[model samples]
Target: MTTTQLAPISARAQFRPGLTPAGLVTVLLGAALPIIDFFIVNVALPTINADLHASTATLELVVAAYGIAYAVLLVVGGRLGDSFGRRRLFLTGLWLFTLTSLACGLAPTATTLVIARAAQGAASALLLPQVLSIIQATTSGEERSRALGLFGATGGLSTVVGQLAGGALVAADLFGTGWRPIFLVNVPIGLVVLVLARRLPESRAHNPLGVDRLGTVLLAVTLISLLLPLMEGRALGWPAWTIALLVVSPFAAAAFVHVERRMERQGGTPLLPPSVMRLPSVRSGLMVAVPFFAAFGSFMFVYAMTLQEGLHFGPLGAGGALTPMAVAYFTVSMLSSRLVARYGPKVVPVGGAIVVVGMVALLCTTLAAWPQVTILDLAPSMVAIGVGNGLAMTTLFRIVLSHVPTDLAGVGSGVMTTNQQTSLALGVAVLGSLYAGFSESLGTRDAFALVIGVVAVLAAIVTVTARRLPDPRV
Candidate 1:
């Protein structure tokens, strides 16, 4: 019997350097910190308000400032990484993030905390785009697939862990610190990541594009105009200024698009090239991302509220209730690459179907058990949701970035993350408002059920839309 020989690796495949295992770990760690910070404050807000004697408005600013700054600067951060060096910007951002985290921990007043939080968000913007850009630039084939999968898992798990850590830390109140430890904890971790990041391989575009000043301004205006109102409107009683900002957002977005298109036509580099957005994979992937992430965000918010208010779980208990989901998500995410390899992009729709089932289960459970529900009662549904989300999110990231060119990795990462952050904010704003309104009229149990039903419908949409995503390259 004759044995068939395997094909030889291509010159480009042989020459392309990949991240060392340690380097992959380091970048992933960097990725986790920003996402963790985003949700960490959710569980700590009440404690923060009590300790700082902060008003409701100030507390809202504390959250909004970070999110706004982070969202607004993400594209710029990606551009900087592509222009300068991914490794350099990663370190710069991490260093600044560390200092800001320290500042937040030591803040003497609510105003100071808000200022530090904004700085922290800006730092995150600088750091996050580099992770994806570096991964995209350095890795290939199975390595790239695995690295992206881990990145997705890190993001999902970090969201859950942030709240858990915050709840535990606040409940512990070590050194009589109250809510300060949540921010302070980042100091040691950031320092460690900074040290490990030294060994990371440096990567950047061969011919980097210069920053587009006008494009940046318009993009920021577009995001701020939209996000600020959505995030603050319900809380501020839908003020006239918020309404005006919302109205201005679409015009700002149109202007940004027109400017970008003109620059591209003139043979100049646009901040976000129209050519990239024209990719079928990128466009379709973003469609899935918006609703998937929106549902995930709203689910997290509503679940926490239900656990704490309706079922009367304390901070720790509420956080702990999510453990089954976290474990399931992490487990499935670790296996996502293998699954995708076997099943292709079909994995996404399968996952979305599972999510629909899980959400429906949750809705049913809430309706039936209501005031009598326990953490145990919620576990099965949580596990299903986690598994489904793990499968869908990991695959979605691969699908979106699969078509982005290596030279444009930074821009791609920035655009993807910006959409993600904006969607999350929108979810919290829209569904959160709906839940609050429904609760006033229908009570917490019925309101939660209704929201879960809505999420199920969104998941169904994901199941259908995911069919449009192109399969990853073999």
Candidate 2:
């Protein structure tokens, strides 16, 4: 069944969730896993390195491979879900993610772990899109808004929690599991979410189509070219070919766009429908999601690395540093609808500016204290920034999906997540590059402070643009 043929719900109707409480919670629980997997590895990376002796470049590939593959394959994954039935794909993906998580935990070599991580990412690609699709097809209006809000809240909080959990798991080393606990922990959660998802619901576009091969291949290549070089470049010492590969990326991207447009015009149900881009909410929200994702990815990567290598923090200290921010993000996200309704997404970017200012102040403090400041000293900034992040992240999701027509929900969700995942990889690359280049002379702590502070400034600029959103309410 192609998406065009589906009639699960009308585009203009109101959201209703009275009949789907168990289903909604089931789906939301399902929603948390992919996000949890996304950032959960950041805190565990040092342990992975110490245990496996992975190079800096290999460690990056471990993270980037998952993100790059997940982004590239997500639209196709959505299409598959639409064609086969969303519930089926959701269940299957959950199982795959669960099994792959085990594989990642058991991987004894860096190469094996990278491969398993890619598979895990692919599983996430299959699992994530169907979530918003289920919500969109099944719910309407206020119900939809609240569901999206919860999804955003959990998603945002998961990134923070991943760090802390990763820290705790590695520190505990349950059953002598060591860092493996980070991935192994997913087994129970995935199984629980999986069993629940099977009973949740199964809905599909009445006539969903099979995957788009041309678009999928082109996108995968485009992302690989763009990401691998960025992630691996600095560690490889910025070779000439890395710059060449980057220059080659735009051409590949343009080709992917052209091919997708052609496919859509020919009624092929291309992975990313051209029409999805025409939505004002999606385009504008994406404008914000891209930079926001990058800023986030940079934060986890650089902070984790700097704390361990630069500040002499063990996994415990580094992870502990993130706890306050995580709490703030969770607390504030639950309040987004009230806030966005009263003030709109405009408040988020304003809040982002405030956060950036707070971040800058914190960085300045680090510089002044230079080699003397402890992680404890940075807790206030972390909490303040978390508050700012909650406002910004939740508002961005609401603003972007608000205008997405109900019929195109799957593709819309796919595009949004793809933008997020890709931009995250890119953000890590760019910020990592800046940090690597700066660290040579500025010293680790100072260089990290400079790089993150600069990225926060860039995030403030992106927020300025995001505030131009046409509609902030759903």
Candidate 3:
């Protein structure tokens, strides 16, 4: 319970077999695929809809199914890695992801694509946590810090890259395959990474616990009950079933909490440990993560819609519009650690404030220019948002993991990522639906401006809460 008790764990970690540069790159590549896939489908959705003759609800499912499955299974995946081995789970996950990607590419129906996507999500859940767990287990001090920074940068940039890549692939229509290449492209990349991953060193918990069946089931039920209703309610015309599910969600979540606490009291491993959640750094960092990621997810989703549907941009143009933001994000993310080293955690609130400014700029521009606004006109605001995002996201990862004991690395990473992915899905469900509803009555331009304003408010909340994060020395 004291700082001295944790020192020996840190000292032992410093002597562990660490990742080679090649191995680090391999795992980071593994890290990128899932985050990229999440946003990649946004631009490709229209094309997928047309070719498969899919309905609105089905298209939403294409996105939601993967996200929901990934979010739900992440902690279990982490536990499996701890119980078996990180490298083993990583390789297994990569192979499964490749197969599922192929399944998605070759699917003849929308329903088939949704099922395949869910499988892909499961594979990702198995794959991603090991990246961080491996880093925590193998490296120490500056090396671990740098690895995590690069990991954060990969994650943030992948969101923009996903949409960009999706649009380019859809527009290329290679062999007249159209949007199918968006998923098909992953097959070769996954294979190459699988080969490279053979070199990664294996690590596992010293006393790995058995999987907690009741806890896993309850957590899944809680998330599904919450997310499914929000995602499908609008398209399904707010059915009685949706309302019932929504009503069930909170109770399910409470039950999950009670079970986890009880299991911990009984000296059994819960999917999420009460001890980890009780850490001030973990709890406060998560407080910042939820709203920040929710806003981020919704912003990306809604902005893509604005470009393609509202501005009438072609797929290529829509994706290309994000180029400025992507460039800024990459550049700033590389420099964010240096800034944190000097400025401490205050950098996060500053980043949040910058995001608000960018959102406000975007709102003003949208109001004034309407459908006439060009990508060139949007570049500055995009750059601002990108810079802000880069600064905040990298630091949030560090803060959450900063105090987590080495032995619980897998569980801690699992909890952090699950919170992140769940927030993303919820954002898309809530704000995306809000945008759609507003567009019907208020016109696309006004609806967009209103949503941007709401996003700005969320960013402001991030600014306020981030001020409370403990400023551990960089």
lDDT score of residue 246 within candidate 1: 94
Say which candidate scores most in TM-score: 3
- Clashes per candidate (backbone, < 3 Å): 0, 9, 0
lDDT per residue for candidate 3 within 165-192, as digits (tens), equals: 9889989999999889889989999999
Clashing pairs in 3: none
List per-prediction Cα lDDT, in the order shown. Answer: 0.80, 0.76, 0.81
Q: How would you encode candidate 2's per-residue C-alpha lDDT over 1-474 as one tens digit per residue?
A: 001112234343243223278888887777777677776687778788889998666777788888887887777777777778778888988899999999999999999999999999888878877777777677767877888666666676676777687788888888877789889889998888877776765666656666888778888878887877877787777799888888888998899899989988887767777787878887777777777778877777888778777776777777888778878887887787788889876766776786787678678777777666677788888888788877887677667667777656556656776777788788777787677678787889778888777777777877688777766554
Full candidate order by TM-score, most accurate first: 3, 2, 1
Instruction: Name the top lDDT candidate.
Output: 3
Candidate 1: list runs displaced more than 4 Å.
Answer: 1-25, 49-65, 107-115, 132-160, 195-204, 405-407
Off by over 4 Å in 3: 1-21, 53-57, 135-150
lDDT of 2 at 265: 85
